[model samples]
Target: MGGNHTQIDFILLGITDSPCLQTPLFVLFLLIYIVTQVGNVGIIILVRVSPSLHTPMYFFLTHFAFTDICYSTVISPRMLADLLSEDKTISFTGCMMQLLTFAFFAISECHLLAMMAYDRHIAICHPLLYVTIISSRVCWQLVASSYLFAFLTAITCTWCTFGGSFCGPNSTDHFCELFPVLKLVCSDTHSSEMLIFAFITFNAVGAIVVIFLSYMSIIHTVLRMCSAQRRARAFHTCASHLMAVSMYFGTGFFMYLQPPSSHRSLDKVASIFYAVLIPMLNPFIYSLRNRVVMGSLVKCGRRIFSCWQHRSFLSSRTRTVHLK
Candidate 1:
């Protein structure tokens, strides 16, 4: 046992002495994962089933919900596995893949959220011109851009993350990551890290800056409206998006923009924030705040109940007919 313990530590740092608190933490995270999955899936179902929600806004939102689910699933299962593992050393390849996939989702989401904000800005600030501006072709183009950007980011991150040479001791703390993994490499990783940092900052920060600009323009436009009622109405539409955009930018910036000081605890904290929590929260933020989404959910709920009741009635009628 002593020899095995020594080998494990030498191999990589693992949670040999995880406190009893870890059990509850695992349970809590499990519950959060379940709810996040169900909520996002439910939103997707409701949005698809309700014709009223078959518009550009809800369409983007459906994709958003889907992305949230993917985002959560990407990190949570591995996180749960880590809690039970004796050795936390992910394979070099696995680490690069995780970092790539995670970056893809994270970067895509930033752009998507910014695009949604721009959608709302066009809708509210230029009501008459909204249709002409964000037509079906344009909407699909925006969606295409999101996917293409994510694909490019994924390829770029994966290539650069693997660009650094790992001679031995391939152990990364907290989980699979680019920087964390790179830190353990025997080679000088400065150039690779710098390249990745530049790419991510440009993608994430640039999207956020674009969002800020659009919102500022929106604010200017809203201020020009003489009617308090119109301003209030516009505010109502904008608040949910603003809140979501803030959460994405705030948590995202915290994750990427910081200096590469490898703090294992902050890695876990930041990981949970942007990866797990935000995905779970997006469905709520998009649905609860949007009137159309709320309506669609209500309609989906009604249709579900009606189907159940109808089936019950039919079963009861069959019994009565057989008795007669």
Candidate 2:
């Protein structure tokens, strides 16, 4: 892979080498990236402006959407640039920074999803205490702790991975990722690999366990309800979250849990799904199926139209009076 170089200054990403495929891939991901940004931004705005959605659930969703926006921004723009550029190279520092930022946001998102599941559990299983249990102070603490933990994890992973010798092939099979980057290291990586595997497993399994326990409690409470409508509403409220969680964790687990050589192509596809497609899908997944969000969107649209009409009417009246 390397001729005589002992250390590398730049890493190349071999996403695809086909000349014919470059433009198509660029357009496709460009569109997806645009939709991802707009959709996530819309979710943030919708949650902010809708008083009916000022509940703890939407509060969690707003933060979730924000995280999606952030990580997507970090990864997609660079990938899109590489698709169009002849040399798909990243500086060592750039790659390290990307890894750090991507890991932090992604890990924070996992904790946030777990917290959301717990919020749903409390909301459905103990409705009366939902507000008291998920107060503003409590919500802030949960979010803050998640972020802090993720930051620390990212630092540890980044430090361990970059501390090794990296004299192998500078080209990565897919975009810059933990496993792909780790594979490029020429030094003994057993300790780094073990640390990464443990860290990822701990975070993923912990979040999954929290989600499982919360959902189990929710199901039991839901089963005890006498009213069909209440049960349906509860299930409906959770459906979006379950979908988002599944897509995020399922793809992430599949991508990271295995060795890179066993499924390089498959892992790349999975990475694209979670990094690009999932972010674009999240706002729709959460908002489209939700009656409250739809209602708020409709209401917001009508208010904007009414205000435009009023402004037009006032402008016309003023012009006529001045002319006469």
Candidate 3:
């Protein structure tokens, strides 16, 4: 909306323009979108209703699940639609909005993961003072701050991204990504690119530093513990979070930090993973290994079955009374 983009009201998204790929891709992405929504929403509900999950860890988890759901919704539905439609176009406004929303959730998740690592650190290293240190107020503050930082990052990046000219190309080779969209600008994007690189670098470095320090401290504390059982449990508690961190950060690091040549083939795939698969898998990663969630699911199942049986019996008795 600034330099040379006045004529461009819509831009094409080249989401696999292959006729052979479109149908299969559409179905695949459709399934993924459904699964992502269901899994993340289930995790949110599980955390909300299960008393065992009402801790600082799960509080952060709930928000993590929520962020995943939101960003996926921002990208996936439109992507799915594009996969089927020949037009494959998104308005300039829609593209910028997607960039902004995606940036917010993506960065928020980075901070949330770091915060979770910190939570784990407190639980393991300073168990005695964990409650006092990470009370409800503190948890709220940490989550709030994570979102606030995300907002600032998104606003800054999005502003810089769209601040320039766009008279070069009206089509993107990939989905509407910050970097790819930057490539389409006719105006000098050096400054905006540098700004984005700086922000991404800083955010990534800051999160990694926090996570690394937290886990390093956790490892030291766990090693000092005498009981094998306690040590095993401590490690078990962190296993899911560590796995999630690795999956998320690994792809993200590769995508953003690597040279453009490396992304020629893997870019879309990596984007799909972070946008679609990771969010879907997070609930399973945390829930399948969790006794609390398993127990809660079982309890809920029993309650539902019992209620159904009661209603059935009531209906039978009413029929018998009426016949008599």
The candidate, 1 or 3, that scores higher on TM-score is 3
lDDT string for model 3 (1-324, tens) is 356555365555546768899898889888888888888898898778878788999999999999999998988888877777777777788888998999999999999999999999999999999999999999999999999999999999998878888775677744677877777778877778778888888898999999999999999999999999999999999999999999999989977876443466568788878877888888889888877777887887797899999999999999999999
Best by TM-score: 2
**Order by TM-score, highest first:** 2, 3, 1
Better by TM-score, candidate 2 or 1: 2
* TM-score of every candidate relative to the true structure: 0.90, 0.95, 0.95
Highest lDDT among the candidates is held by which one?
A: 2
> Model 1 RMSD to the real structure?
5.0
Which scores higher on lDDT, 1 or 2? 2
RMSD of each: 5.0, 2.6, 1.8
Model 1 residue 294 lDDT?
86
Candidate 3 error regions (>4 Å): 5-7, 259-263
Assess the local accuracy of residue 139 in candidate 2 as a C-alpha lDDT between 0 and 100: 92
Clashing pairs in 3: none
